[model samples]
Target: MKAGTPDLATLGHRIRHFRGERGLTLDQLGELVGLAGSQLSLIENGKREPKLSTLDALAAALDVQLADLLAREAPSPRAALELELGRAQASPLYQSLGLPPVRPGRGITDETLAAIVGLHRELQRRASEAIATPEEARRANTDLRERMRARDNHLPDIEELAEEQVRASGHRSGALTHREVSVMAERLGFKLIYVDDLPDSTRSITDLANGRIYLPPASIPGGHGLRSMALQAMGHRLLGHQPPASYDEFLWQRLQINYFAAACLMPQEASVAFLSQAKKEKRLAIEDFRDAFGVTHEAAALRFTNLATVHLDMTLHFLRVNGDGALLKGYENDGLPLPTDVTGSIEGQWVCKRWRARRAFEETNRTTENYQYTDTPAGTFWCATQTGRTDATEFSITVGVPFNQAKWFRGRETTVRAESRCPDESCCRRAPDPLAERWAGQAWPSARLHAHVLSPLPSGTFPGVDDAEVYAFLEAHAGK
Candidate 1:
C-alpha cells in the first residue's frame, strides 16, 4: 500500500494559517522552516510540498503537534485567540512578558478565600524569571524607537500621531467624545457595572492564570475622566500586563499610564497651552471645553491637578477641570489612602484647589470659613486665602501662573482661579476630606467598552489585598 497520499501541500497550508492566527507573519514562520516567505507560500498554496523533515521542523518551530498542524483548518475563535496571544507572549515587544494567565472563575478573589494560593504562589516561581529586565527592554525600546522614526518619516503630522496613539491605546476613532471611553469598552464587549455588583474587596481588576480579564466599571458620578482612563487601563491590562499582586503597585501603574495617556491624547506644550488660554479667560468650563478643545472635562481637570507641582510654593496653581467617583486620580498624591465608605460622587468643581489649600495652610496661610463648594454639592475645601493682610481681599489673584515657566511644572496644568476662598467661615472649610474633596461628580465609570470588554477568568483568580499571600503568589509565578 502506498503511504497515504496526503495533500501534503494542503497540510502545509493548514500550518500556515496556524502560524498566521498566532500572529506570525509569513517571514517569521518561513525563517523557522528555513525557507524564504515566497517559498513557503508556494508550498502552502499547494504548488509544492515540504519534505517530511521540513514539516517536522515547522511543527517544532510553531510548538504544535505535527499531526495537529497538518490537520487544523479554519480553527475556532479561541484557537485563533491562542495564536494571537502566543504571538504577544513571545513577541519582543513587552518589557515584561507572559503575565500569569488569569485563572478561571475570576472576578477578583479575596486574599483570605482559603485557597490554592500556596499552589498559585508556587506557580509564580517561574514568572519572575520572565520579568523583562532593563537589558531585555533595551532591544524592545530600540525596535520601538525605529518604528517611531519610521512613523515620523512616513506621517510626520501631530494629528497623525494622535490617531496612532488612539489605535495603540486600543480605541477607535470617529467617536472620541467625552463619552468615547465607554464606547471603546462597549466595542471591546465589556459592560458598565457597579462596584456593588462585585464582592467586597474583590481583585477589582486582574488577569487569571487561565487567561480571562475582568475590570471595574467606567461610569461614576463625575467619573468621566476616570472612565476614559479605565478604558485604556483595562484595555492595556486586558492586553499585555496583568493586575499587580500589590494594590500600591497596581494603582501606581494605573496612575502612571493614565497620566501618560492624557499626555498622549492632549500632548505637551500645545495641549497645556490650549488649556492655559482657556482657563485664563474662563472660556473652557467643563461644558465649554468639550466644544472648544474637543476633550472631556476630566481631561481639563487633570491638567488642573498638575498645578500642585512642588515647583511652586504656597502660591497654589491648579488646572481644575472636573470629575467624580472612586477613580483615585483627583488626589494629588497617589499614595493617599482611600476611605472604606467609597464616596462615589462629587459635584463639578475643579480638583486642584483642595490640594492647593493643603499646601497653602502648610505654607502659613490662615484657614478660612467653611464654604459650600461651588464645584460640587459636597463638603467645603480650602478655596483660597490672603497672600498678606494687605493683599487685595476679593481676589488672591485667582491663582495666576508666572509670566513664564517659573511657576509651572515643566509648563503644564495652566490654571486660573474660578474663585478665591471666601472669608466667611461658612463658605470655606480649612479641613478638606481628601477622598470627598477629590471627588468631583457622581457618574459611574462607564460600562466596559465592548471593544474593551473581555471574557472572565474561570481558572485562578487574583488574590485580594493580602500582601504576603499575593507576594508569595507573585514569587511563585515569577519563578515559573
Candidate 2:
C-alpha cells in the first residue's frame, strides 16, 4: 500500500499461492486472521490492499515470513502467465482490436498462454518498427527545433568557421561569387567538377580520395543553387563531419552543412550590417536581403531567422508552403502559432488559408512579393510572402514578425489585413454552414494520395539514397 511496495496484484497472487500450499479455504484463512470470508476473498483477488498488520497475521497463519507474502515476483508460472496476459489485453493496441478479453482459467494451457503473449509481442515489435523512422525523425526534429530556438538559431562555432572560410576565399563583397565558392572549395582541397552523370539522389558528392566535388552540369536558377551546393559539399570537410550512423545524426549533419553554406554565402559581418542599416531606415525586407546577398528568397528568409534575434534583437518566423497550402518547412521563435502534428513537427501540416503564405498564391501579380497583416489568437503579425515556381510545383516563402516589430520592415504600409483562429476547426478547416448544408451528403470526391505518405520511408544508412548506385557512379567517375 505504501511507496515501493510490491504491486497488489503480485502480492495477492503470492498470498493465494501460500494459502493453497497450506491446503486452507478462504473461510479457514479468514478465521485465522480474524476477518470475514468475503474480505479474505477480496484480498486474494487483488481488490483490496491488505494492511501491514493483516499481512503479518496472514504470513504467520500461512507459515511464511512477511517478506514472502509481499514478494515482487509472481508466486508461480501460472501466476506470471496470467499477469502477462492481463497486461497484454489491457494494452491500447489490443483494446483497439475490439476483441473480448481472454481470462486465463485452469482450463487454459500454459502453451496457449505463451503463444498469445508471443504473438502480442511480435505485433508490438512490428508496429514500432513500422512507425519508428517517421516517429523518431519527427521527435528528433522537434528536439532540434527546441535547441535552435533556445540559441536563437545561431551557432557561433559554425558562424566562426564560415567567416574564416569566407576570409580565406578573399570575399569582401555584396554577394559571394561563383569564383569565391570555387576558391573556398579549392582551399578545402577539393576541385569543383561539373558532370553530366551525377547521382540523382545527391545534390553534390565529395570524393574524398581524389579531392573532387562533383556537381550536376545543369544550370541552377541565378547560379545560387550551384554555389550553395558546392559550399555545402565543402562544409562537410570544413566542419569535420563523418558519414552519419543514424537518421537523427544524418538530419543534424544536414542542418549543419546547410547553416554552414548559408553563413558563408551571407557572411554574418556583412549581413548584420546590411540588416542594421535597413532597420535604421525602417526598410528591412526579405527581397532586399535576398538581392543584397544574391540568395533565393527562401534562403534569405531562413538566414534572416538566424540573425534577426541574435544580432538585430528581433523575434520572427519563416515558412515555406506549397501552393496546395501544405507547410513544407517552418521555424518560429516569435510565438507565432503554426500548425504541427502530434509529434510537434510542422512539416506536412496545413497552414491557415488566410495566412500570407497561402494567400500569396491567389494574387494575380506574380512579379512581386505579397504583404499582409493577420490578426490571430496569439497576436497580430505582419508578413511578406514571395511566390516562386520550381519545375515541379509552385511554393511561397514568407518571413514575418509580431505587430510591434512590423514598423521596421518595408512592407508595413500594406493595406491588406485579415483575422484567423487557427487550430480551431471553425477557423479555416470547416466549410461554411450554408455550403455544408447544400452539399452535406451529396459530395463524394476521390482523394489524391501523396506517394510519400503511402510508402514507407526508404531504408538505408542515408535514407532514400541507393548506396549501390552511388558506389557505381563513383567508380564510373573515378576513371575520369
Backbone clash numbers for all candidates listed: 91, 0
lDDT of model 2 at position 387: 96
Error of 1 at 50 (Å): 76
Model 1 stretches with alpha carbons more than 4 Å out: 1-175, 186-196, 202-226, 243-251, 260-273, 276-299, 304-480
Global local distance difference test of model 2: 0.88
Alpha carbon lDDT of each predicted model: 0.41, 0.88
Clashes of 1: 91
Decoy 1 TM-score against native: 0.30
Cα-based RMSD of candidate 1: 23.7
Report the C-alpha lDDT of model 1 over 1-480, residue by residue, as the tens digit.
115434544455477667876788879988877989998888765578778788798889888887776663434433333333333334343324455543323243433222334444444533432343333333333343234323321222333443445555454332244445544444455533333233334444332342322334545444444545545544454335565543333433454455544544454445445556654554433233333444554454444444323212212222222122112222323212112122222112223343332233234434331111222222222232222222322112112222232222221332422333333222344445675577646446866443312422111223223444444543443333
